[model samples]
Target: MSLHEILFIVFSTVVLLFSLMTVLSRRILRSATYLLLVLVATAGIYLWLQYEFMAAVQVALYAGGIVVIIVFSILLTHHIHHRSKPFPPVRVITGLGVAGLGAALTIWAILQHDFHYHEAEPLEVNAKVIGQHLVNTGDGGYALPFEVISVLLLAVLVGAIVVAKKDKANEQTSENK
Candidate 1:
């Protein structure tokens, strides 16, 4: 096998293994750590595909930003070594069934699609062009989606803070009583 194929296999394996680990882990903190590994592996795949910008964003936004936020939330709300309750047999079976169905559908779709490769000149990509596109509101621009996501993230942060404060308030009231 070629070096590219080897690296792809390695990255894919890491991503799949860590993704499974992330879901199956009983400890919230461990799950978050596994998710971080999965994200980093995904970034490796992006780097292998020559999408440097995408790889950086995956590492920075997902592995760095999102995972840190998740870890912090977990630390703030739960004990560090807390473990999740075991899944009931019925729930486990249902989850497996759904996962099987999804996998089957994905494989079927892949089989039905025809992909063709074409040789094309590589386009120049840089931070300046990316910045312009992000701010542009015209055709093919991502300004609207970017702003929407920013608003959504802000809302989520506000909601989290409110919930945390409410919980503390309730705890204080109970203590006083």
Candidate 2:
């Protein structure tokens, strides 16, 4: 097989394996670590596709920023060695059924679609073009959704802090009594 095909297979396998590990892990910290692996493998796939900007964003924003925030939140709110309780059989069966249905639908859609592949001149991908696209409010602009996601992340951080503080306060109250 060609090098490109080999690398794609490797990256895809890593992503799939780590994704399952992330979900099935009982320890919250381990789950977060597995998620980081999944994100990094996804970045590898982006790099293989020659989307350098997307790969950088995947590594920097998702692997670096989001995972760090998740780990920090876990550290603040729970013991380092905390393990999640086993999911009930009903939930497990439901989750598997949904996953199977989604996979089947995706395969069906892919089979039904006719993809036309044509070689075209590559567009210049630079920081300036990316920055403009990000800030532009016109067609294909991500400005609004970007701002919304930032606000949502801020809210999540604030909520984590509030929960941690409440836990500490309860602990102090119990000690005093």
Candidate 3:
């Protein structure tokens, strides 16, 4: 009935649709693009909820940064247009069963829970506070996790380089043969 409700419905629908498309798309690039749409729609929901700072971070880190990295990775692998193989019938049926179970559990949980919604005054976003929490050594600190993720990304890049070199080497050897 209200504008906020209408926007929430729209954004949520966009997110769900794009998320489904992202998972189902055969082309790697199309899947990545769909994922980007899902992330942007999620950011819109954050904005609608008046979490402007969170929305900005979602757009910047997820929609902008991660999606760009994914797209570039696909391009670098020369698999931007690669079509994924279809799942076997048994695998597809199993996957559908698991997904249905999860959905049913989620719906049951939502129906059982009583959520209290309170409209609070919007607080100012403090960058300093956010930065401190990100690096804090105390409880709920994300410093270690952030470092771990950086290491993981570095490892992935190194692996990609190694694979690419091997492929080139194989090609050269075959040509020589």
Largest lDDT belongs to which candidate?
A: 2
Q: Could you tell me the TM-score of candidate 2?
A: 0.86
Q: Rank the candidates by TM-score, best first.
A: 2, 1, 3
Global lDDT of each candidate = 0.85, 0.88, 0.83
**Candidate 1, which ten residues in sequence have the lowest lDDT sum?**
155-164
lDDT of 1 by residue, 1-177 (tens): 999999999999999999999999999899999999999999999999988867887897778877877777777665569899999999999999999999999999999999998888976779998788888999867788668657866765676566567767888899999
Per-residue CA lDDT of candidate 3, range 111-170, in tens?
A: 999999998885455988778878887785668866865776677667666655676677
Q: At residue 163, what lDDT does model 1 achieve?
A: 55
- The most accurate candidate by TM-score is 2
Judge candidate 3 at residue 15 and give its lDDT: 93
User: Which parts of model 1 are misplaced by more than 4 Å?
Assistant: 124-131, 138-140, 166-177
Q: How would the candidate models be sorted by lDDT, starting from the highest?
A: 2, 1, 3
Residue-wise lDDT of candidate 2 within 1-177, one digit each (tens)? 999999999999999999999999899899999999999999999999888877987898788878888888788876669888999999999999999999999999999999999888977879998888899888867788678768867876787788678878888899999
State the local distance difference test value for candidate 3: 0.83
lDDT against true structure, model 2: 0.88
Model 2, position 170: C-alpha lDDT score: 88
RMSD of candidates 1 onward, in order: 2.5, 2.3, 3.3
Clashing pairs in 1: none
